[model samples]
Target: MSEKDQRIQTGKFGEDAACDYLIEADYKIVERNWRCRSGEIDIIADDAGRLVFIEVRTRKTGGRFGTAAESVDRRKQQQVRDTAQVYLRSIGCSAESIRFDVIAITMSRQMDSILEYKHYEGAF
Candidate 1:
C-alpha cells in the first residue's frame, strides 16, 4: 500500500477503535461522519442524557505534533461547533446541555496496537 493508503487505513482503524471505546464507556452512538456545509463531525453520541459531539484524531506517531487532542486548534473548534449546531437544528434537538469531546487515538508500530487514548470532555 502507498503511504496515503496506510494513513487512511490507520485513521479508519483508529475511528473504529474510538467508537468501540465510547460504546464500552456507555455512550449511545447516534451518528458517524456527520457532515454539514460548515464542517464534519466524526462521531455523535449521547452520554448520560448529554449530547456529545466528538472529534476523533488518530496519529501513528505523536512526536512532532504532540497528541491528537492538541491537533484540534481554534479554527477546528469553531468548525465543530458550527457542525454541531447544524446537527442540532436538523435533529430538532435543544442546544441546552450539549458538550464537545475529543477522542485521541495513538497507534503503535504494530498498527493494531493502541498506544494511548485520551478522551477530552468539553474540549471546546
Candidate 2:
C-alpha cells in the first residue's frame, strides 16, 4: 500500500480502538467520523449525560516523531472545537453540555500491536 493508505489504515485502527475503550469505560458512542467543511471529529460520545467530542491520535510507540497526544497542537484543538460547535448547533444543543477529549493510541512498530491507550479529558 502507499504511504497515505497506510496512514489512513492506521488511523482507522486507532479510531476503532478508541471506540472500544470508550464503550468499556461506560461511554455511549453517539457517532464516529463526523465531518463538515470546517473539520472532522473522530468520535462523539455521551459521557454520563455530557456530550463529549473526542479526537483520536495514533502513532508508533518509540517513534522518533512524538507521542500521539503531542500531535494535537493548538491549531488542531481550535479546529476540533470549531467542528464541535458546528455539531452542537446542528443538534440544537448548548455548548455548555459538551467537553473536549483526546484519546492517544500508541502502537508497537515491531509487532504492529497496540502498546497503550491514553485518555485525556477536557484536553482543550
Candidate 3:
C-alpha cells in the first residue's frame, strides 16, 4: 500500500482500538467521525452523563514526527474546542458537564498491531 493508505489504515486501527477501550471502560460512544464547519471530532462519548469530545491520534512507534500524544498540539486542541462548541449549539441540550479527551495509540510498524495506548481525560 501507499504511504497515505498506510497512514489511513493506522488511524482507523487506532480509532477502533480507542472505541473498544472506551466500551470496556463503560463509556457509551455517541458518535464517530463527527464533522462540522470547524473540523472533525474523532469520537463523542457519554461518560457518566458528562459529554466528552475525543481526539484520536495514531502513529507507529518511534516515528520521527513525535509521539502520538504529542501530536495533539495547541492548534489541534483549539480546533476540537471550536467544533465542540458548534456541536453543543447544534444539539441544543444542556450538559451537566463537558470535557475533552484524547486517545493516543502507537502500533508496531511491522506488525500493524497496537503496541501502546494512552487515554487523556480532560486533555484540554
Candidate 4:
C-alpha cells in the first residue's frame, strides 16, 4: 500500500480501537466522524451524564514528526470546541457538562499494531 493508504488505515484502526475502549469503559458512543462547517469530531460520546467530544489521533511509533497526542494543538482544540457548539445547537440539547477528550494511538511502523494508547480526558 501507498504511504497515504497506510496512514489512512492506521487512523481507522486507531478509531476502531478507541471506540472499543470507550465502550468497555461504559461510554455510550453517540456519533463517529461527525462533521459540520466548523470541523469534524472523531467521536461524540455520553460519559455518564456528561457529553464528551473525542479526538482520535494516530501515528506510527518513532515517527519524526511527533506523538499523536501532540498533533492536537491549540488550533485543533478551538476547532473541536466550535464544532461541539454547533452540534449542541443542532441537537437542541443543552449539556450542563461537556468534556474534550483525546485518544492517541501509536502503532509500530513495522507491524502496524498499536504500541501505545493514551487517553487524555478534559484535554483542552
For this target, which candidate reaches the highest TM-score against the unseen true structure?
A: 2
**lDDT for every model?**
0.90, 0.92, 0.91, 0.93
Write candidate 1's Cα lDDT for 1-124 as tens digits.
9989987898789889989999999999999999989989999999999999999999876457677778899999999999899999999988999999999988986686888889999888
Question: In model 1, which runs have C-alpha deviations exceeding 4 angstroms?
Answer: none
RMSD in Å for all candidates: 1.3, 1.1, 1.2, 1.1
Ranking by lDDT: 4, 2, 3, 1
Clashes of 1: 0
TM-score of each: 0.92, 0.95, 0.95, 0.94
For model 2, name the residue pairs that clash. none
What digit string (tens of lDDT, one per residue) describes model 3 on residues 1-124? 9999988888888899999999999999999999998899999999999999999999888799999999999999999999988898899965458999999898997845788889999989
Q: How close is candidate 3 to the true structure, as a TM-score?
A: 0.95
Worst 10 residues of 3 by lDDT: 88-97
Against the true structure, candidate 4 has what lDDT?
0.93
Range of the 10 consecutive residues with the lowest summed lDDT in candidate 1:
60-69
Candidate 4 lDDT over residue span 1-124, tens digit each: 9989988888888999999999999999999999998999999999998999999999887899899999999999999999999999999977569999999998887745789999999999
Model 2 lDDT tens row, 5-96: 87898899999989989999999999999999899999999999999999999897777878999999999999998999899999998888
- Score candidate 3 by lDDT: 0.91
Checking candidate 3 for backbone clashes, the offending pairs are none
